[model samples]
Target: MTEYGRQPVERQLPTEEARDLIALVRELADREIRPHTAEEEAAGHFPRPLFTLLSESGLLGLPYPEEFGGGEQPYEVYLQVLEELAAARLTVGLGVSVHTLACHALANFGTKEQRAEHLPAMLGGGLLGAYCLSEPASGSDAASLRTRAERDGDTWTVNGTKAWITHGGVADFYTLIARTGADGPRGITAFLVPGDAAGLSAAAPERKMGMNGSPTAQLHFDGVRISDDRRLGDEGQGFTVALSALDAGRLGIAACAIGVAQAALDEALAYTAERRQFGRPISDFQGLRFMLADMATQIEAGRALYLEAARRRDNGLAYSKQAAMAKLFCTDAAMRITTDAVQLLGGYGYTVDFPVERLMREAKVLQIVEGTNQIQRMVIGRHLVGPESR
Candidate 1:
């Protein structure tokens, strides 16, 4: 009844190794992450030490190539591990997803020299990362970003502010995108900027409704400079790189949503069983029981949807449409499920004494990040038909 990911999920793992990996993740989550989540979250502490532990345990770089200090696990297997971690704490799960997204450009499009020089440290060297795309005015319309990077001989000078950056002030590196040509998507180029570089600064973190343990703030690049060798992919290809990274990042968000929903349900189940109602467990009530059934059904469905998309991605199939669908449905389901958990627990769920309240708050950001649910629907609609008329 108190298990993390043991929700009777029918996993079609490709190998014994994958199954073992999931077991190890579950153990790590329960022992290392879950026990301290509530207290640290209450204090708004980021638990950087636990991240170091995750890196040391090889959990930080599971989905990339082995040559780059990664575990080389398939997306399907990697997402399942994410589900387990998210069930323990979203700060850890979502943080890992952002870090992986930050590394995507270099890993997929960087030169061999760039990969050999940076991948080892980024993957397992206990370095944290942040993705910079959204800005003060360009969030959903990420292509409209105005941050500019002007090249000067062998170096590039950057100046602009990026808003809503995760791990903002604390990240070891930033995967930055700034306009380098005419306005629009094609004008952008990607660069890997060291966090401590001159003139790189982060504003104070935003006061959020949830995920208080994680930082969300703006990054300012005031004449920050980097060599051309730090550029990722071709100039004017930054938007393409960003979109490609998002396709995989959407799946990661979907998995994390399911994990949050599952945790909410777990909390509801424990509370309903122990706190007797009318001389018996509230779990015996027909209405409450049916709600639990619905929650479980949604979690299972979301899990399957993300895994299906992940499998398509792993096999090199075109999975953008499915990924959009998964992100849309899974996050919507999580919002509904967590809200239901709060209602099922009645009063305690709304109080800090229980975990459901925090879960409900955390479930919300999942719907908004990695591309909002509305954006996901737009992606699905365009895939189904075609781009809408202006």
Candidate 2:
């Protein structure tokens, strides 16, 4: 259960069905997910079995159409469920979001035949997915990507190095973007590639300061071949598809950020009350009490902001700007709250004995992934003043 579990969130759910859905998710999360988070993360393990359980429980495809084996929940409900999962374990919550992003292209733009053949299994059949957009040199400057996909009548041979890919070696499939023509965004094309395809391999995962439970690595595609039938959307339109998926994905990151902050707050509150200081509980101190209040307030504010953005998305409105804002603010808040939790605990927070130390390390990555916080500001600025012609 999340900090949302500690104190119930008064949600504006559209139906009783949604309310019951969230309750069940929380019960399962508390009973099954949180128990292993600390032990598994410390061992730097990826819990593939946990993801299989999530898929089996119908949690993997919550925000998509029910016709494709999804639950068809709206963004608000999906995101809240994400918050609970992240509060239980960040690896699982973010993994689900990436899976949803990986499925976006075919579900939204694939031909009817493609959907019927693949969407059901991809969404709920325990298959994991990876979205490949950021390369070693083309993360923020995405239009300048150098991966090439040469088409030959019936097949496309892909060659490139994709960097910073989560679920890199382990994912069942990849949603790949590679340059097909020209030199800019217009030339990029999206393709679905099988994980076991020849000439495709993942490098050793990057050794990171945190989030050890999730693997991140560089992928190499050396003339990996796929049928033209695997192409998603139209040639030269991959950038559009990527951007659309990211707009929704940013909301997921925002929700996950709030979940981390809420967890950190919960930890701090629990520790302060039970922790003895100067012959009494540390909660008796004025200074520590103020810190707790501020942490709680930041979490509430982040949750509200992200939910507002989610509502805009569920209404089918333009929400890229709001999504960017939420991602930036919520991630930054998570960093602050987690760090504060460590500080409030004094030396114990700095050691592996406390979960706050791990939470602090994990919070650092949210600012960097899905697009850096700097990129979020650029997106928001462009929306406010219109993009400058280049």
Candidate 3:
């Protein structure tokens, strides 16, 4: 029986490829990450060697093309890898997801020359990336951003501060969006900003309630100059690129959410079986059994939602609405399930002595990142009304 009051569903298992990826990720997690999770979180520092190990293992660029030293894995297979990583450590899962988000621009919009020049380094080594779309004035409403990028002969000078950038100071490169035309979304353009560019800097990392191991900071781009070759797609196509990248990014977050929930469930199951209440194992209580059943049900549904979206994406079918739905449903489910997992732990869950509390905190961020759940709902609602009305 699944713990945390969840009943087992029909057992919708992963494909053979997904199972293989999951097995590999589990081995990596157990061998390299799980032991240091507490130390890393307490110190609010990321483990650089972890990323280097991932790069060496060919896991950092799992979803990219093989020509760039990536595994060229399908989205279905890639997401399971994310789920396993997240189940072990949220910081690592999010780090990989954020890197993949930054990579989307180069993969989908970069010129062939740009791809040849950057993809190898970005996909290999210890290189990391940040996606700079959110600004101080534009969190949920990204189109209202005030950052500007002006053309100067052969160079573009970028002037703006991007808010809540992951790997802000430490990234090797950034996929930056700035205003190159007018005032709205249509006027924006994407640029590949190397982290070593002059005039580029970051604020000290934000002190947050959770996920401390993943640094979050504000990025400053003050008159940072880039050649025309850095522009991603056309001058007016940044919005398209950003939105498209987000669709794929959302799936990554959903997978991460499931992984987090699974970890919580795993811990809860182990704890309850060993933990006794009223002189009996709490896992034997019908109330706790029901709760575990519900948690498992929700996780399965969340997994199904993301997998369906990934399937559509893989088939070259329209998946914007489905992607938003998956992200919204899955993250929201994670918040609920992880919270209940802590509740079921009954006091121990509220403390650092157990992992459920950390899982609960990690779950909250899922609802806010990769486009807030509110934004996801709006995207889904808009699509439901058809594109003509808006």
What ordering of candidates by TM-score runs from best to worst?
1, 2, 3
Model 1 per-residue lDDT tens digits across residues 1-390:
122333434578999999998888888887899888888898899988888888777877889999999999999999998888998999999998888899999999999999999998998999988999999999999999999999999999999999999999999999998999999899999999999999999999999999999999999999999999999999999999999999999999999999999899988887778879789999999999999999999998999999999999999999999999999999999999999988988987788887888899999999999899999999999999999999
Report clash pairs, candidate 2: none
Sliding window of 10 residues with minimal summed lDDT for model 1: 1-10
Worst 10 residues of 3 by lDDT: 1-10
Clashes of 3: 12
Would you estimate the TM-scores of all the predictions? 0.97, 0.96, 0.95
Model 2 poorest 10 in a row by lDDT: 1-10
Q: What lDDT does each candidate get?
A: 0.91, 0.90, 0.87
Question: What's the ranking of the predictions by lDDT, best on top?
Answer: 1, 2, 3
Please, what are the lDDT tens digits per residue for candidate 3 over residues 266-340? 778778788997999999999999999999889888998998898888888999999999999989999998999
Q: Which stretches of candidate 2 lie over 4 Å from their true place?
A: 1-10
Off by over 4 Å in 3: 1-18, 387-390
Q: For residues 1-390, what per-residue lDDT tens digits would candidate 2 score against the true structure? A: 222235555667888989998898888888888888888888889999988988988898898788989999989999999998998899988999899889999888888888888888888999999999999999989889998999999999999999999999999999998999999899999988999999999999999998899999999999999999999999999999889989999999999999888888888888888889689999999999999999988888888899899999889999999999999999999999999999998998988887898899999999999999999999999988999789
The local lDDT score (0 to 100) that residue 166 gets in candidate 3 is 89
